[model samples]
Structures are given as C-alpha cells and as structure tokens.
Target: MVFVALLGTGTAVAGQVRGPAVVPLPPQPALPQLPWLPPLPPVPSISVQALPPFDVEPLDLDLESIGDSAQEAVLQSLQALGTLRESASVSVLGSLQDGFAFRFSQQQPPRDRTEARAEALYRSARESIDRGRYENAIQELDRLIDLPGTSRVDAALYWKSYTQAKLGQRAEALTTLADLEKRFANSRWLKDAKALEVEIRQASGQAVSPDSQNDEELKLLALRGLIQSDPDRAVPMIERLLDGNSSVKVQENALFVLSQSQSARALEIIAKTARGAVNPDVQLRAIRYLGAIGGPENRQVLDEVYRGSNDAALKRAILRAFMTGGDRARLLALAKSETSPELRAQAIQQLGVLHATTELADLYRNESSAEMKKRVLQAMLVGGDADRLIELAKSEKDVELRRAAIQNLGLMAAGRTGEALKQLYSSDASADIRREVINALFVQQNAGVLVDAARAEKDPAMKKEIVAKLSLLRSKEASDYLLELLK
Candidate 1:
C-alpha cells in the first residue's frame, strides 16, 4: 500500500515545461464613463443672454447612482451633453457630485474626465445611428455634429435625415436625404439616403406636398414634370416610388399615368393592379381606357373583364366596342342581362346604326322612348335603311326627333323624301328643326335656296356667304344661283 503506482513513469513527470495554463482571476474593473469623443460646436451664436444667469436648474434626482425618477434620463442626458461646453464645467460638476449622478457613477469628477473619452462617446452615437439605433443614436450624433475637424460630413447629413424623419420633419428629411445623395454619394450612408429621397419624391408626386419653402416644392415640381415630358422616365420613377413608400392615391396616380401610356407591359401591370386597385374610380378608368385602345388583341386580353365582371362603366366600355366589331345577336343576348338602361339604349341604337334592317325594325318599333327611338331611326338612315327612316319621319311624334329622321331620310333617299323635308322647312314648330330642314333641302337642291339667300342678303358678306354655301352643295340649283349672284 505504501508503494504508490507510478503510472506516469512512461511520460515526462514534473521537469517538462508546459506551453501555458488557464487561470482564474478577479474581475477587471469596468471602464469609467468617458467624455463625448469630439467637442461640440461652440455654443450656438446666441448672445449668451438667452441662457439663465444662474447655474442649471437643481436636479430633481439623487447624485449617487443614476436616479430612477422620471427626470433621470433627461437629467443625465443633459449633464452628459453639457461636457461639450467648456464653460459649463462647474455647473456640470455640481450636477454630477451634489444634486444628481446622471452619469454611471458619483465617484467620477468633472476635472478627472478626458475630452478624448468624450470623443469616443460621440463616435458611439454616430455608429449607433448608422446601425439604426435611433433612440440612443440621435443625441449622440447631435453631440458629434458639434465636433470640428472630425469631418462627419456624410454622417452628419445622414443623422439629420434620420432625426428629422423621426421628428416628422419629412420635408427636412427629404432635403437632408437629397443633400446626402448629392454631396455624399460615395459615403456608406448614401444607399439609405437614396431610399429616403425616393420616399419624398414618391410621396410628393402621389399626393399633397408639404407647404415648405420654394426648394422642396421645386424638387417635387421637377419630378412631376418628368411625368409628362418623359413618360418612360416617369414610369421608371413611379416604379421605384412603389418600392417601400407611397400613399395609396400616389400609387393610383402612378398606375393611372402608366396605364395611359398604352405600353404592353404597362397594360399588363394595369390589369394586375386592377385586381387590388383600391379606388373603384381608378380601376374603372383603367378598364375604359383599355377599351378605348380597342383592337382584337386589346379585346382578347380584356375578354375576362368583358365577360365576367359587371362594373357598369366597364360594361359600357365593352358594349361600346360593338360600334366597330358588332355582333348584333351577341349584343341582343347581352342586352336582356344588361342592367344599365343607358348602355342598353346605346347598344340598341348602335345596332340600328351599324346593321339595321327592316327585320330589326321590331327592336326599334317597340322602343317607347321617342328620344331613343329617334336615335334608332337616325341610325337606320346612316345604316342604309332609307325606307325605315322615311317611315319614322312620317309617324314619329317628337317633333325634333322626327325632323332629324326626315332630314336624314331626304339625304339617303335622294329626293325620295323631298315632300317631307319641304313640310319641315316650312311648318316645323321648332326654329332649329326648320333650319335643319333648310340645310337638308339645300342638300337636296341648293340653287333655289341660294337664289333666295342671295336675294334676301342685305350685307355684302351675307351675299358672299350664301354663295359659298351653295358652291359646296354642288347642285344644278347652286350653279344657277351662283350665275345669278355673279350677275
């Protein structure tokens, strides 16, 4: 038992030197709170009369550890900041030792503080803001802004934008952002600055601008002007505006202008936007504009919109398309289901205007509204249904609508409705309808009217004007009337 097993005999026992050994030690003292890194700007150009004649107000908190009172943070922050002012040394020292220990400790005295240490603190503020530590960072960066020769040019501009944005000085933020983007484009803060600039531009463009001085207004004006002079440029700008910041109305205006460009991509984007488009007015406008740019390709792309949805204005847009590519049977099918009375009537009238025949007469015959039926009958005259036009002129009760039908019938029938026109020109109750009949009669045979007009003219200009009207009529009557006028 006394013979301890020398198990370590094979290895070097105690004489071998080891490389290093881990050791436990007492905790190192934490570093004391240092002065702000750089000195602040000399107290502002105030005449020094603005400040209190006495020392700073007595601290409402204890001078031991940082107080827990509501005033502690503001008190400590102010005391810490006061170090930047050399004249405030005695007052700051009193705040630290006697009334309130706003800093980390009461043991540290003002005389013992290092300005270099203060510079470090100021630098920490800038670094904090750069890292987006807004609450803690603003005060620190503000202190640093006073420091000379550190040339925190880009940092200063950035923190200005950041703090102003936090303080809701959006115009100021935008100004600072623009300056940073311009003067400090190469700085690390430039990307964020550019972002803020975009926000302001997009914001002002999309909605109301702040009633700031001339410069901010100028910036917004320049961007909006770009929208008109260069839509391609404008469109890209609006795209970037959508990135992170835009009011809803701003977004809609951007989409609206882009939609109007009629670019293919713009159309697709508009269609997609239509799904979530917040304002129904903007959405319907987009759809109607698409219809106005009508073509087979246009309609095909908008086919679902035409067939599925029931926005009245949008449906009117689709129905209006039949003005060119009319499928009367299809229109008739859609007509029964169509809810809008106005559009239904327009569709009905367009039918007569495009391809009206006596067989479709039933559609117009049963139409009760004299105003609308007159539109149908007028469409018939234009649509080559001359006999139908004459029939309406003979029987229609609304004097003006009937006169329009009769006048158009005379033109289409080429003297076949002459008797009807003569009656309208001579006896229609309405003065306008009589004038319309006179114009139509001239269209039928201008020489007689031209002679009468020239005979009735009291002024030289009137005589010349009547002859000019006859010349355009290009009738036998016009030639005779012109010959008589020359005589």
Candidate 2:
C-alpha cells in the first residue's frame, strides 16, 4: 500500500466537510453626491498609442504530469487519485506526487550500458538483502563497486556495509562505511550510513565515542541515536554542537534533531540557543525552528527578541517568526510602537498577511504619516477589506489618501467595488478624481458603465479619454459598445 507522508505528524481523523467560511461584512456609512463633469472644452485629438499595453502574457494552463521513472505502485496510486472525492485525500495525493517527482528528478542518470548493468546488479543485491541472502548481496554489491564504469558506487558501498553488518562483520562493516563516507561525501546515503553505523556500534557494545578521538561525524551519529532513544541525554550534546565548534551544516542538523524532540529540556535548550547563539546563522535557525514548534512561550521569546535587538535584520527575522507563530497581538503592538517607520510599516503589512483586518483599520484610522497611511491602505487590500476600503473611499479627508483608497478598490472586480467607484464619481467635484474613478472602472473591466458614462458625458476630452480606455477591452460586448459610439 502506498502511504503519503503528511506535512505534520498528527494523524488526521476524517471529519465532516463544512461549508465555506462566512466573512462578516462591515457597516458602510452613507456617501455624499459629487458633481458631474462640467460642459465641454475643445478636445485635442489624442493618439491611441498613448494608452498602456493591454495584452498581458498569459500563464501556462498545461497540467503537470508524473515523471516517467515513477515506480509502478506509485504510478497506480497517482492514477487512482482522480477518483478521490475528499479534498483531504486530494491534498495528500498532490503532496505525495510532488515529493516523489522531486526525488525522482534528483536521481543521477546512468552514463552508459556499464552503468546500467551496475545499477541492475545493485538492485538485485538490494533484493537479496531483503530476502535475507546477506552473503549473496554483499558479493553482488562488492562486484558492482569494483566495476570501472559504475556511477552508483556510493550506493553499492552503502549496501555492502549494510549486508556485511547483517552477517555480523561489525569491524569490516565499519571500515566499509568509513570508505563510503570519505569517498562519497556528497552521497545521499550519508545520513543512512551514519545512522546504520551508530546502530551497529550500539548493538556490538562499542562506545558511541571512543575516549581518544574527537570525530565530529561520529559524534553527530551518536547524537542522532540519543535523540531517538533518550532525548534527555541528547540535549547537552546538541548544545555542544551549537557552541561555535561544529560547522554550520552540523549545527543546523543538530537543531533539526533537537526540534524533533518532545522533552521540555529539549525545548528549553532550543529557546536558550535561539536567544544566546552568537552565530547569527545558528541563531536564525533556532528562531525559525521555534516558530515551527510554536507555543505561547516561544512567541514570548520572539517578542523579547524584537524588543531587545537593535539589529534590523534580526528584528526582521523576529517579525517573520512572530508571523509564523501567529502572534497577532505582539505584531499589532509592534506596528504601533516601533520607532523605525519602515519596520513599523513592515509589521503592519505582516498583520495584513495574517488577515488582522480590524487592527489594521484601527491603525489606518490613527496613522499620522501620509506614507504610512498609504501602507495601511495597501494592508487593507491584502487583508481583503473590501468594505473598509469602500468606507475609506467615502470618508477620507485627504485627497491623496482617498485616491489611494480608490486605487486599491480597483484591484477588486466585485460589484460592490464598482458601485463604490460610481458613487465616488458622482460625489467628488474634482475632475482628476472622477478620471481616477473611471480608470478604476476600467480596471474592473466594467465596459457597460463606461458606455453609459461615455453616452451621457458632455465634456469631449473626458468622453475621448473614456473611449480610449474602452478601446483596451477585447470582449464582444466592449467591441459592440465602441462600434455604437462611433455610429
């Protein structure tokens, strides 16, 4: 049976499918009527080339397919995915295929017939090992490793060690694994090799670390074993690895193993490392892992980091960490109080990304800086605050701020957005703002409104501009309306 690896560890119990989430609409206040365009001044003939390019590059609509190298069982599973009615199952299947495709693409291709034969032999050896024919597997793997043209000697070496260990050749197996490690440093089998080596050492009553040597890889191997069998014992070793002695790669791996542990001591060590690691990369890694293993405590630590660190980069990282942790209260507080206006704007934008509409609108209401208020308008758009945007369009006193509101409203194709634009067009006396409203209607591709407006318009310049905008639309209805205007 094919099993899809889920993103999280928790088992999903099938639950009842629910309807779409209902967003509660905010109350819109009454809008005032604006003056219509005044009587026509003489229209200067405008060239159509002055308009912006209308044709955009369309996105690829082709469906992605499974790679040809997929195993038969995997291919069958993908084929059956279309019949699944549940969204959950479809999501799981999609992730599985994506993961499989990535791994399949990473596999090295055989160079020639010699390499192909070596791979076949290697597969046969793996089959032998699975069937408990250790001697035969070892013989086959050794032969493959000795072949001059074999591209998969790393795999052959790994399986040889595995089969040797199966036959109780611990010392020989360890030697073979060392050879594999030294020769194939970039091999994908390195992690499994390290794991198997550690297992063999433990089973043979050999110490994980000998008294004389400081082998970093061996220690890392031992650390991995302890994390699984006894995470309490693993914490100190992990802390040691994080202490500027180990390479960044080893330290990051240590952080990954530490994150996997469920022990309170493990979490405490992670928090401590996140706070105190002098290495910025290590510190960043710990912070990200803390975000992944989120809780109130982790959120508090990030909040403290944001308050204490003067490093803009570190503060930015903390902002993202808080975003990941879903600490909206902290984010809102930062958005309000951050001394740096740029970071304050970033925090407000993150709040929008998190869909904190009420808080964002509140910020917009009190925001004193013109530039910062524009950012707030952008945040409202990101948060899908259509009603709030309409309200801002109607109520904003600053002309530029109101323009910003109307501009973002154009991004929405909703009928309400079009209606808000029409209302603004009728109420505001500024021709420039009315032109903006017409541009917004163009953005919504509302040709019918443009036709009606064009028909009723007395200002020849405004009418010409409306027709020019209408010329951008390619729909049959838009074409028919333009023909009628010409007639």
Candidate 3:
C-alpha cells in the first residue's frame, strides 16, 4: 500500500526505508482551493501631446508704472548695493583722499589774541629790520613792548636797539640796550646787549682798533667790516690767518669770511684749505664751506679732493658736498662704481637727500649685493618712489629683500602702499610674508584693509595676529570690526 501510495503521489516517505516500517499517520484535513478571479484589463493607451517650444521673453519692468513707495524702495535697494560695492572697493584700494589730499593739519593750539598780536608784531619787526626798514621795525617793537604779558619783550627790545643802531640812532640804541639790561637781568640777550653797547660806544667816536682787541668776537666783527670794505685786502689777511697757527675758531671765522667773498683769490684759498693743506679740523670745515658755497668751481674742487684723498672722512664729506652742489651725475657715478661699500652707500644716501628717485631705481635694478640693494631701497624710500617699492615688494624673489621692500612700503603714507599691502596679504601664501604684510598695514594705520584681511583669513593664529593689530588701532573701521566681533 505504501509503495502504491508512493507511486501515486510520486514521493518518498521518511522512515519507509527497507529496514523500518512506517508509522500510521493521523487523518489529514482536505486542502481548500482559492477562488478564481478574471485577468486585469489591458492597460489604457494614453498619448502625450508634444507642445510647440515657447520663447521666454524678458519682463518689461516699467519702474514709472509702479507705486511711489515700491519705486522708492527699489531705488533705495540699488543705492544701498552701490554703496556696499563702493565701500568694499575703498577698503581694498584705500581712499583717494588718503593718498592725494594733504594729510597734515595744524596740530598746534590756537594762540590767544594777545599772544598772536605779540608774535605778529615781533615777527614783523624782525622782518622789517632784515629789510633795513628801521622805522617800521621800531614801530612794531614798540607795539610788542606795549602788549601785556608778551614773552618776546626782551627779544623785541634787543632787536629794536639793533635796528636803532643800524639806522644811526646810536644814542637811542644805547638807551634801548640799557633798558634791556635793566628789565631782564638774567636774560640770554645780555651778552648781545653788552656787545651792542660796545659797538654803539665805539660808533660814538670811541674807535677801537680790531687788531688791538683781544676779544675774538670783536676781531670777527672787525674782519667782517674789513671784508665788506676791501675784499682784496681781507682775502690775503684771511689766507694768512688760515695758514698760521691761529685757533680753529679764528680759522673758521676766516673761512666764513672767505666764503662770503666772490673773489677768485678767496676761492683759491678755500680750495687749498679744503685739499687738507691746513689742519685736519680746518680742512673739514673748508669741505663744509665748499658745500655751502656751491658752484661749478667748488664742485670741481670737491671732486678733485675726493679722488686725490684716501681719507674716508674727507671722502664722505666730499660726497655731502656733491649733494649740496647738486652734482647728481657725480653722486650717481660714485654710487655705481665706488669700491668701498661704505662710501658707495654714503653716496646713495646723499642721492636720496637729493630725491634722486630715478637713479635709485636704476641702481636697485643693477645692484647684485643684498646690502647694497637694501641701501638703494632706502634711498628710493627717501626719494618717495612708492611705485618702484611696490614693484619690488610684489616681484622680488629674495625673501629678505621682498620683506625689506614691504617694510619700506609700510613707512610710506597710505593710498597705493595700503592697496599693495592688501593685495599681498590676499595673494601671498607664505605665513611669514603675510605676517610682514600685516605689520606694514598696521604701520600705515590702514585699519580698513586690516579689517578686510581679518574677515578673509582662515588660519586661527594669523587671524589672532590681525585681531591684535586691530585692537591697537583707533580708526572707525577697526572699532566697527571689533564691535561686530562682539556681536
């Protein structure tokens, strides 16, 4: 039966193997069949219509048709946007006024009316005296003396006396000098007062010979008179004094007298003394005199002395003379070819004083030595060559040289320098370079750029450094940034 069942079912029963009999199973319940359902209807065939392409036209927004309030709002929004853009640009580029406008204002406290009047009177009196308008000077001096609490009273009195003496009113001058002595016993003008008294008394027929006088000051006065009276005679006397073992004061006075003379002999004597023919002290003085009395001849003398002498001190003096004589060509030649770095640097410095910006830029380009380049950079700075400095700061490959250029840019006033520093801070990746830029901006008091940089900086330490710099600033931009930080 189990075999018949297995054949009918086409299955093998567990435990029905040949060695074991199958246990009789309990009666199984009949299987229930599920109800049959019809097939789903064919899916509906829907077609999508292809529409023609529509052109998107711009809206014709007629602002005139809008309500007044709406139009006003739009205008305000545009203006605000414009202002924001302009402010952003200004922060980055710095203001035109900062660069072009006069930055300096009168910081001196306003003088009170009384003080002002006194000063005006004193100044006018001195100017009048200088112009040989003794009467006008006397008038101004009297007014100054009459002013209450005038500090220039002593000065006015001394000048009034001098003016009187110049005007040949010797008696009136002596009386004025006496008044000065009585009023200000411990005054600095007392020495001048005594000298004036002697001068006035001498003019009053008490003629004292300059040669007999032991006073160096009196001798100098007499020498001045002699030079004015007879320059030819004074030149020989000055040469004798310079050549002799006279005191340096006497020699310097003689040199000064010689400088005032336009005579050829005077020039020759000055040239000789400047050539170290005299004492070292006198030679140095003569070199200075040559600079003060600048001319083609004086410059030639200076050049000859510079080449002939190996003395560093004298060469340096000649360099100064070259500047004073306005011999830029000579200075440039020395700055370019001088073997002594010290003297070359000195020549470059003198060029700076002469505001030789073009020459300095040329020198910087041709220079190979780092130290010499730095000196040239300094000279450029002194010459106010901001454009060149900006160029170097941007393109110089030497890290230290670039840093130097950046540092010099900081010392300059705001405007282009501030803009260049902002750009450097934005583009440079070197932490050290960026740090230098930050320092430069701080030096320029350019808080606007500093604030902008701080906003854009990602490094925490760098940002902190920028913030620290901001804290020291007193600008509106810096204050606003700090307030924003608090919020």
- Best-performing candidate as measured by TM-score: 3
> Which regions of candidate 3 deviate over 4 angstroms?
1-216
lDDT of 2 by residue, 151-215 (tens): 66887887788678767899999999999999989765676677667767865986654421235
Q: What's each prediction's clash count?
A: 14, 4, 0
TM-score of 1: 0.34
- Model 1, residue 25: distance off in Å is 99
Per-residue alpha-carbon lDDT of candidate 3 for residues 289-399, written as tens digits (9 for 90 to 100): 788788888898898999998866578778877776778999999999899876887798767657778888888889899878877776666556788889998999998
Q: Pick the candidate with the highest lDDT.
A: 3
lDDT of 3 at 250: 55
The alpha-carbon lDDT assigned to residue 468 of candidate 1 equals: 53
Clashing pairs in 2: 33-427, 34-426, 34-427, 34-428
Q: Candidate 2 — which residues are off by over 4 angstroms?
A: 1-229
Model 1, span 185-205: residue lDDT tens: 666556556655655555555
- Model 3 clash pairs are none
